[model samples]
Target: MSRISSFVEIYFPGVAQRFQKGIALIDERYGVKAMYGLFFNFCLNVSRPGQVDRLHCLPHADYKNLALAVCVVFVYGEFNHKEKCWLVMWEAGIILQIPPGVFVAYPSALFYHFNFDISNLEVCVTDGADFPTPQNSRRLDGGASGRGSCVWFNQASMWQTAEIGVDTIKQAISQGLDATCDNQAFLDSLVFAKIMGDKGQPQPTL
Candidate 1:
């Protein structure tokens, strides 16, 4: 997790700073790291060796997560990433071809996203093919081939508490802030800091 955090800090410095700010706020509020205070969590998609039906999900938005914050996902494992595990984003109308050990960050609360099915295509040529099968997919140490994702995100409640002095929209409204007027203004005031790239250019957005 430290290494992944460092990588994001190096490449996506703005995102790293945003996460750290949130973490600091939460830690200060609770006087300790909460049980779910971690910036990243692992989800191992394990299955039978070479199983083409590995775990997946339907298109959905993570409504409970912070809307202004981005979710960072790190995909890794021994599966054939080239043919399988592409990320399908409905709002973007694009399927991202993320190779193994790569990291992708997006606003999960805004985009409806899912994954492609595990590849079932058979390889005809061996020149540069990545065809993992039951017989050859197992590691020498007998570990099964599978995929895993590490997701980093901030919960909506944490940000709400930090920014609005409350942990829920209802609480904020009850405290005299109008949801459609003052709430949107408060959200607008909480802008992400602009990040400049090494070449003096603004960082690109997804």
Candidate 2:
């Protein structure tokens, strides 16, 4: 996981920095603990018990996620990556062929994305040691014969708390204001607010 975090920071430096800032603010103000000592929360997805989707997901946008935040998705399985699972971004008309054990980072809140169906594809579990594996592996068996993904991201509410010092929706509700509209307005204000841009202030040394 540390290696994965480093990989993301290397490829998406700006996003990683923004995430760190937001997480730091929240930690100081609200005592929220960072997941795995990082700014992003993690989720693992896998095929249902006996049912096949093999992490093949439906098209959807994470509407309530931080607008400018990037989601780092790590794809893994034993299927043929070349012909099997692929990430599709509907808004950009982009289909990413993500090889197994590789990471792809994108702004999930801004795009409708999903994975290509891999249920119909046969799983080929290899023991040839051709697949990437941990250095401490005891057996020569290859990757798992089912698709799964590890996604790391920040919820918009986390950023909202970091920025406003409180949950805006709850505050709005207490004041008898429309929570939904207030939340949307607050999120719109942050869509391009530049969380890390220099604004006549000293930048923290990372």
TM-score to native of every candidate shown = 0.66, 0.66
Q: On residues 1-206, what C-alpha lDDT tens digit does candidate 1 reach at each position?
A: 66666755665565566667767776777664633333633444545555543545677999988675567787777766656667888988988877778888787998999987434344322333568666556322212247766677766766666655566679888999754424464444443434688999886544
- Candidates' lDDT values, in order? 0.64, 0.67
lDDT of candidate 2 over 30-149, digit per residue (tens): 787777545457898876646764566778998877776577788877666755667889988988888878887788999999876343444443456677345423332222247778
Point to the candidate with the largest lDDT: 2
Task: Give the clash count for model 1.
Answer: 0
Among all windows of 10 consecutive residues in model 1, the one with the lowest summed lDDT is 136-145
Q: After superposition, how far is residue 18 of candidate 2 from its true place, in Å?
A: 1.5
Off by over 4 Å in 2: 48-53, 117-145, 170-206
Q: Could you tell me which residue pairs clash in candidate 2? A: none
